[model samples]
Target: MKIDAGNVNAVPSKRLFLSIIADYDLNRSICELIDNGLDVWTRAGRRQPIVIDVHLDPDEQSICVEDDAGGLPREDLGVIVGPGQSGSVATAHETIGIFGVGTKRAVVALAKQIVITTRYQHAETFQIGFDESWLNDEDWVLKVHQVDDLPVGTTRVELYQLRLLLDDDNIKMLRHHLSATYANFLTNPAVMIRLNTVPLEPRFFDNWAYPPEGSPQRWSGPMRTPSGKLLRVDVIAGLSKESSPATGDYGVYFYCNNRLVAPAMKSFEVGFTRGQAGLPHPKVSLTKVIVSLNGDADEMPWNSSKSDVSTKHHVFTALHDWLVTVVKHYATLSRTWEGQWPEKVFVYDDGDITFNEVDDFLTAKRAVLPNLPVVRPRLPVRITKANSGVAQAKPYVVGLYEGVVAARTLVKQDLSQRNWLAFNLLDVSLTGALKEYLVNDAGAELSSLDLAQLINRDRTVSADLRARVPLPDPLWTKVEQMGRLRHDLTFGRAAPKISDEQLAAADAIVSEVLARLFDVKLAA
Candidate 1:
């Protein structure tokens, strides 16, 4: 605890201690080297085709990353070799890096030494070397050697004395990690990445581009806020073409300069992804939201790592607050459009909803057939969470929210459009629920015009008919019991199921709802 600031010896710059190198794993180090090459390509704005080839040879006990991108300049070599100094490369698209420590940290984390071979255009090839033994002594300078073998306009990273060994599985994992981390980049035809001479294909997702079918369920042209800032919003919801894992892909992603900085993040305001911020997983898996910032580096929200957004930044915070609700409303629309209550809402007390005594007063309020004031029942409530879920491929959706309804296709592809279902959310004071199902399903799909007209006419008709969606006593009691049962289920307590008598009572309530809300009678 004593202060001894008198004499401090200089450690080999960029401090790569041999012992600390073991702290980082092999895959991460490999990713770091690859990210360096990627940053270079990003700075150039894809004017040239960038091809990065990674060579992982366990037998040789070395890892190499070579890219056809514009290599580091001679003046810039002093920074990477010495410390985590990012030279004057902080442009808008090029701002993903911070302090330029990723490659340095990853190199030191994986091995005791590294040799960087690079050339810029027709410039002479130069090599920079760092050794672990320098930590014990005073060897700060990395001798730069000119070499002729390295290709012109390229850079290669050769890692030796690796702390972690590489096998087939490790190599496979590295490939997968790269695919997920840079999936957005891979989506572009102009950008290509390879592992061991094989080109890695980007995982495709529905609505990634414009839909091949009718049109995007929801699309927003570029909109400018009051502050004169540009914003882009694109939204798609419902079942994936081949819904693989039920919770595979969902949620809104934030992209900076065509690169995904935060994948499927619930906005800071209303974020609901499974297991994060005390919100349950979304009931449906096919929902995907894309909110991107295409502006220059000044407006981007990315941190130094390029993996997260800086919530505290002034400019980004303003833009996010201004445009976040637009995306969230679209998300709500996506979930409610199809009207699957179990998939659309989550019941029980999560501090959002408070269930009071069952109000079965509707059945008594009206006394005739086709009773006007249809008291529509609202089931589970929807919540927003902030965290994201595990990543997935095939569907490019960045799965963030969980608890999505498992996809069970009645008909896989409704090519004729007749099989598609029509439903809309109607705001009703009944049950204090915002979701009101207009039509569950019919033989035909609702055309855009019909949908618009229905939406415009719903309030007028409901007001005129005096429709009140009332939860009958028995059904309301059943739902109330189910809500409590969910608590017991969460607490690992044994819960009992409703008997035939209870079910019959519930059925009677359902029939009443049908009669009052949609004017249909259930079979006996």
Candidate 2:
């Protein structure tokens, strides 16, 4: 082999396409483009509110993300396709683009043909296109052309000939993903993002608080990394608004440089132990942990996709123990609150439950979390040890009334259930009593006309009988009443409806019938 030059050919192979984009799905890919626009806006000092519009046209099999953030300078536009090249000039703590491959990877992952149109501030519009041909070859050369009649001072990325055509479900998911990913940015009154003409609404935590005593905890401090970068960390743990226990909506969330890197993470990696021993309990569904890390983008403990945390990273490793401790503490408190705490309101006795936002706590001055007021062991505790004298007994009386109402409700419910049960007992008892009197005692067959006649007679007719038979008038009357009541309840007949008094009478009748007739005593 003749070595004309010692330089190695380092052009990226076509296989690089799969490697760069393999991990991204439709939602995350779109997020990468959004991140680029926001990063550019930050780099340009955010002179005006950045308006990013995402339009997903399934019928056209295309997506267009246009942003009013300052467009790329023509000289620097090559960075869009050049691996490791970047146009961002943001400081370590201000940017979201770190590896500089997010835009290119997102473009290729989405479509075969990509057209990026841009116009630098007060400059002629320029456009560049990347197609299947360019993707198939190893050539790094690209041509940018001046274009007219285009939007000025803006950048537009259009992806057509989609690699995976979007459907309704994909569009819905993309909307949600973008809403969550840029929640911090969208919270700014200046920023506006639209998806399919509808404005994007950010999803942030709605934490619960009973102020002065029970509020979310906050701890924020700056730490110097081993590499000497200043990293700021803020951790807030508290109760969130009610959500389904089965959902991932109530757990640890991570944000790096105001971008949501992970949402509602409740696995072993984030201090939720495996199995039922830990956070899986329904009582802890209100638990919310928000961790904000703002610092050098490269130093943050996040993966390239920004979809997960890099647990092995030293920064995260240092944070893991503390994170676990904090989560466990709040999770225990959550369980306790659900199990013991009364209605979470500032007023102790009576008011609708109110909650303060988690952001309020996150922004508060750093301090040790105040211990929650001792949750009364029982709800509506009107007669605590501190309570004294006759006037204070008014609280006890009010509590007694409330208790009476609740007890009455429960008793009525039990009575209703017992009525159905008593009906069942009536049928069985009548049959058993008849068998005992006719067959076992009087030694007569059940089919005998005399026995049937004896049992079927109404209370009036049976009242005249003086034969000293086991078929008594009282039993007959009780059976008839129970049967009619059962019929009325089952068929929605008129009332003499089921009540506590009626249930008690029925129970007494059943007990007498069982003991006097069927020989089975009702257990006390």
User: Which predicted model would earn the best TM-score?
Assistant: 2
What are the per-residue Cα lDDT tens digits for candidate 2 across 386-483? 23332253332223223222332334332546444544444444444544455654666556666566655233334322253544677657666765
Q: Where does candidate 2 have its weakest 10-residue lDDT segment? A: 396-405
What shift in Å separates residue 402 of candidate 1 from its native position after superposition? 28
Worst 10 residues of 1 by lDDT: 421-430
| lDDT (C-alpha, whole model) for all candidates | 0.50, 0.69
Look at candidate 1 and tell me the lDDT of residue 396: 16
Q: Candidate 2 — which residues are off by over 4 angstroms?
A: 1-7, 90-93, 209-214, 274-281, 336-524
Model 1: CA > 4 A from native:
1-28, 42-45, 82-84, 92-95, 135-139, 187-189, 204-248, 266-270, 273-278, 282-284, 322-327, 330-524
> Relative to the unseen true structure, what is the C-alpha lDDT of residue 19 in candidate 1, on a scale of 0 to 100?
36
Compared with the true structure, what per-residue lDDT tens digits does model 1 show for residues 427-496?
Answer: 1111112023333222224565654453332213233112233444554444344334333433555533
In angstroms, the error of model 2 at 176 is 1.8
lDDT of 1: 0.50
In candidate 2 the C-alpha lDDT for residue 262 amounts to: 87
